[model samples]
Target: MLTRQEITILQELAKQYAEIASLPIQKEKRNMWLKLNTIQMERPMVLIDQIPWHEMDVDGFLKTKVSDPHWRGIEWEMRTAIYRWHHMPADLVVNPYICLPRIAENVGWNLPFHAESEVGQYGGQAQTHIFVNQLQEMEDIEKIQPRKIIVHKEREAEMLLEAKEVFGGIIDYRWGGFSSHLGFWDFISLWMGVTNCYIELMDRPEFMHAIMERMTQIHLEEIRQMNELQLYDINTNICHCSQTFLPDLPKEGDIAVSGNAWAFGLAQLFTSVSPAITDEFEVAYMKRIFPYYGAIYYGCCDRLDDRLDIIAKLPKIRKISCSPWSIPEPFAEKMPDYCAMSVKPNPAFLAGESMDEDSIRKEIRRAIAAAKNYNRSVEFILKDITTVRNDPQRLWRWQEIAMEEVQR
Candidate 1:
């Protein structure tokens, strides 16, 4: 049973959430996303994610009142969602339901790696870490193990029951599988330092290939197990922070496969790697997994301007990320018509002591002009926002600028 304070807080938030979700604009935004995802021409969509919430305490709007840990988490979600909608609702769709995952523990994968970091003064989204290389030699690769998913059905049932008790009458509650993003090279870099990993690609090519092969097998097995356990969440509303409300996905009451959902792939560490080496190590392994998904969203922060041709060869490729590091003109000229360009403006502009509205506007306008020239569907995604200099107004103003540019 919940405390009276918890009940009061959650119920009030649920009612407000339900009211906002019931608005006609929610459906309109979803339909717009569907059109954009399906390669149909629609106005560009703008999204802001990876916010530095520790700094967004405007008049104590983000301060938590609940005492229970679980309730505190739920409270934060509700507060942030409502805050974003009110302040910068750029193509954000507030669904009418709250989803709790089927509680599961990841077992196996015995390989361990460690890192050391310096955190920000406020201790939230600002941090830098240097990974210690754990996989130091070829022999160490033998220690790699397959991962398993161990679902706690009883706990999931209990949580679902408790959520229903709190939110049943106010809004819908869904028990869903965990949504995941898949990228192998990033993990490899954590195990082997980035410089060492790059050296291995050149000096120890066969060793790198063997490691990739093993990682591929491990991931494929994990995906198969999740499918067997019915733990794949195909109805997820977002893919890598961009909307995923496409029309081709399986509808309600339909049996879903891994292919019925979107798969995300990236090799951010391969930013400076040559296309041939990338294809040999990254694309070769990723392609083996891409066939399992109905659609693919690929790349992050990696400058893919020269590598678009390499990326286009992957199966079911629907969207490609164009980071601030990438030259927008080359990407815009060469991107496939069917694939939407998920443009990420530089978050550094927001991290300054003050907002640089001019730089932000020029960067966004450049992307817009390039996309329009090629008749490409564009989605402006502002992510990796590690700091706002303790000023939430900067983010709010950034959103205003983004929406203004996209709308124009």
Candidate 2:
């Protein structure tokens, strides 16, 4: 149930959304295309840690003095690394917040509180408990049940309003994963540990599926609530989702992540796994859960180029992962239209190369030159990025490159 305040705000916002969403679908498509271009071309992403998720001294952020008035000049910092994504040639993921599930652990599952980067830095179990030997014992797993007042409600609401106020709508407070990004796999690896769950899959197949399906339902409900509230329609650039495997499609009726649509992550993950393994256990599953997100990337944060032909069949996918090792040209040629490219650079370049201006310049140039012929507009994401201690200047290259190209 929405609060009177929420209803009032949303009713007003709904009028704006109707105007926005009513723009010709082609125009919206063009807008997204332009946005994708902005990602690949213009505005260097300045990954601002606009929202510090480490149990923010929320009061401090809310009350702190802001002397700088310009949007570009607005002063802010984060507990963890945040790139100025607009200037950098990459996707802008609002830091620390992207890893929401881990953060929420700080507030307990039932409360509406979010997990802070402090909590994420520590991380947590995919499935909280391990070795629950009894069937009924499994029932007590962590979940944020519906129909209850969420905790941290005040913090979250306050943060949202503050961001909107200061940023003048530039700060996009996206509601990302509150549960597992991986469908059934979230519970298996989280609770049982990957190794333990793998063995159980073969040793106790039916039990494993039941547990995975159950966990998936809990997770789906979480996403469903977010979707119902129009939370998914926030200023988010893309409805981004990823996982390890994919499932095969089925002929007839099957319950999907949403009402009738299967989840895309499952389909992509299946394509990544070896054919023999998929044929035995995952083919049927992927076939059913292959239609949710508009854009999907699969496989080990690596270039899923090998899986492209299979993935291309996904009508809604608009972005595909391009790993450092993946051959860019062929994959670029192969990705069916509308699928933007997500390029995963070798993190070694960021850490290994000497942090001289020339070296950083060359690295950015080489990446841009290499990605010149990509299937769609490019997205350079640095996964496992940990350091920038002495290389603050390095972040500027991506944004500079995109700005230079877009103008040309």
Candidate 3:
């Protein structure tokens, strides 16, 4: 029953290396995308998911404690993202990813939808209080009452079942359910503030360990339920939560980047920590998490270039995210043959600073070609594309040019 499009998204949802990427976008252009009848369904927007917003007031947080608009908001965001996928092909294939802005707003995070900004930095997101910070807390963390974790995960499962029933075999739910944007470091930013979390990492390593341990415990249980229920999605913010469907999958060779699907999926991020610290502090923890998934993908916000040395350290990584900040030269040279290289452009492009039309076109072409040259499947994800949402022509032109360049 899932629309043909939903089915395509679902298929990727089931894959370990299901690619997650984005690109510049526009609202008027989005409206046009919804209107288009092209059903390649193979385009990015086919994935399923939901959004996770932390830092809500008691009323807002408890609202979901019962049943709240945040649940309903998931449906709203999914519809919009799915509609967009139908209109034009996206650079990075994205599943549904969304911010819990409305729920946050309703529950009193007081998030505002600004006229100039398609997405906002403040008031719209949540504050994540859970973490792997306490090593001793891991046991207690594992026992985290579903009552607490369900603050959001429960609603996600409900939506996933509903969507699955509505869409049927057309969509994939295994690895395509609810994921996180407020992952590891991002969540630390929510609770302690990025700078503060950073400070604690240095001044209070013990505190940091406790947070990660507990967070990891909570994450383990969260994944266990979703994995059993076939609902835990691993994309940022969330695809099922954020949009109506799963993101498009990784290109051919990208799979080799993510260590392995661990039990189900892998959570990778770019912490501002130095390479030495990464080796000392992060790599071991990261390695522990990899063996549990079916496929693995690596690199988050961090330059894939700097982290490449440790790539092999990831036992079964199937995909690697290539950032604008990351250099693909090494990937092209020594990348494991099985890994998928997901190349990213600057989200700042949406701001239209250095990313003028000619420049973006050139940049995309170069990126695409570079990926192809390495025999790596490439995805162009403009994570924050709302910058040009109000301007349809610009959005249309960008899509048209991107399609023209990449299709070749």
Which candidate number maximizes TM-score?
1
- How would you encode candidate 1's per-residue C-alpha lDDT over 318-378 as one tens digit per residue? 8999998988888999998889999999999988777899999999999989988988899
- Most accurate candidate by lDDT: 1
Scored against the true structure, residue 52 in model 2 reaches a CA lDDT of 21
lDDT of 2 by residue, 1-408 (tens): 234454344334333333333335424333444565333433222121212222223233323233422111122222122223223423333321211111122222342322222222212211123343223234533342333213355555664554455334322233332221433454334445445555665677676556645544554455555445323222223333322111222113332223322233432333344544443444334343444432244433434555566656544454566656766677667766665566555544544456444544454445555556542555555554444433544445534544454334
lDDT of 3 by residue, 1-408 (tens): 234554443344323122222333434333322222122222222111111212212232212211334434444334434434444334323432332321111121121212221344434442223333322233433432331222355555565655555445443332233333224554444434445556666886776666666556655554454444443333332221112111222233323122112222222334466766566555656566656554454555566565567665776565566667766666555666665455555545544533377777777777766655765544455543434423434444556667777656
Cα lDDT, model 1, residue 173: 74
TM-score of 2: 0.52
Show model 2 residue runs off by greater than 4 Å: 1-187, 197-208, 238-272, 275-300, 313-315, 356-375, 397-408
In model 3, how large is the Cα lDDT of residue 196? 58
Q: Residue 239 in candidate 2 has what lDDT? A: 33
Root-mean-square deviation of candidate 2: 10.9
TM-score of each: 0.95, 0.52, 0.56
Residue 238 local lDDT, model 2:
32
The C-alpha lDDT values of all candidates are 0.83, 0.40, 0.43
